[model samples]
Target: MQAVLRAACRAAADLLFPRNCVHCAGPVETGSYQYLCPACTRALQFCEPPACKTCGYPYFGSVIAPRECPHCAELEPVFDKGKTLFLAKGPGRSLLHALKYHQGFYILKDLTRMLKETPHFKEFLSGAILVPVPLHPTKLRERGFNQSEHLAHTLLQNSDARAVEPLLLRSEFTHSQTHLDRKDRLQNVKNAFALSATANLMNDTYYILVDDVFTTGSTLNACARTLRTAGVTHLRAVAIGHG
Candidate 1:
């Protein structure tokens, strides 16, 4: 009854003040996603198979032979594999920015919907334990939330993932990697993470690191190194977008 009431209330509220697209300042009238207009929804470039195993970037349909992904060519990943939802361009970029910067919590429903409907997405996440990339204490206090942690929870609810484990902690408040080169980004995060005291990982179980976006993968690699040092043998990673 409460859920029904909430839905009814939301419907009435939407009618009163229609939601605007995150990418464009247009009314979201008809689209599979609630936060994007139909054109923007159609503009999303989803990742498909024959993708880069390291960063989940598509191979542009080149099935001839697997080649190195330019995105993470220099990365030496501690995790066994990586998967992402879409290219972090166009509407996809705005979607993540909205969540990461604007406190767009309402956009989570779109993630759930995508996980349920996107081909092979749920399968990739269904059986693993998810670990969200951590934010430093200072950053956490400033941001009031960790977007990666929110992503982990949404994935847990949407897929058959075992559980969400905050098994890593950012011990150092590293400078933001937004404008840094790949080398600088790596150096900034090096030795910045530590294994959390609450972590009780098993050798045989699959573990997947979750984040909102995959840039040069420096940050994720840093987190994975910490987990690997703590004896996570079966590990992989997933993100909403590959930038």
Candidate 2:
């Protein structure tokens, strides 16, 4: 049977290339769908309610109502809204580091699965085009592949979004925003992105910028600004973790 052959192929592949858990790097248990080990799964801090409505940053206050955070309030972001699947800590942090530095391409499958389970994911992506925040040609060459682009492709597999469109192009190669403060982060990415010359952005079309992390949000904001300037009105973002 076709199913039997598929199973046998999977078994052979497993034998040839043993899989490891994305979080713990331990040998994956047979038939386990999640990339994380049981311990790492339990350690993940899923973003919950009372988060910022605009950015989806989780809050731990006793207050019951959800509201915008000061960062969102002070300087309104170009994107309409954003959401992150988990707080960038604990197992989530470790997994992010692996995916960014190491060739953890396999982790995208489990991450997309987790993102599908997030509250409002369907509504968030409805009628939207997935856009991966692009990397400069030099950086892309050095990294081999863009992690954001891979994440966007994984998300598109299950969503009805139009497509994973590389509409935004990085114009300048700036320093990594990793250790930069908020102000410096903003400056580093300023004018760093531009809409592709051949991009055909529809009027009133929604765009969801995809990225790996949402630390200060400067990178996403820059991408959003470029899209907005290109006449994109409905803009938002989604990421794996909220740093």
**Which residue pairs show collisions in model 2?**
none
Error of model 2, residue 159, in angstroms: 1.4
Regions of model 2 farther than 4 Å from truth: 8-18, 30-32, 67-75
Query: How many pairs of residues collide in each model?
Result: 0, 0
Write down the worst ten-residue block by lDDT for model 1: 59-68
Candidate 2: what lDDT? Answer: 0.81
Best by TM-score: 1
TM-score of each: 0.95, 0.88
* Local distance difference test, each candidate: 0.91, 0.81
lDDT of 2 by residue, 65-158 (tens): 6555864665468888888778788778877887888987767777766766764665667667999999999999999989998888877876
Alpha-carbon error at 227 in model 1, in Å? 0.8
lDDT by residue (84-181, candidate 1, tens digit) is 99989999999999999999998898988888777587888878999999999999999899999999999999888999999999999998888999
- In candidate 1, which residue pairs get closer than 3 Å at backbone N, Cα or C atoms, i.e. clash? none
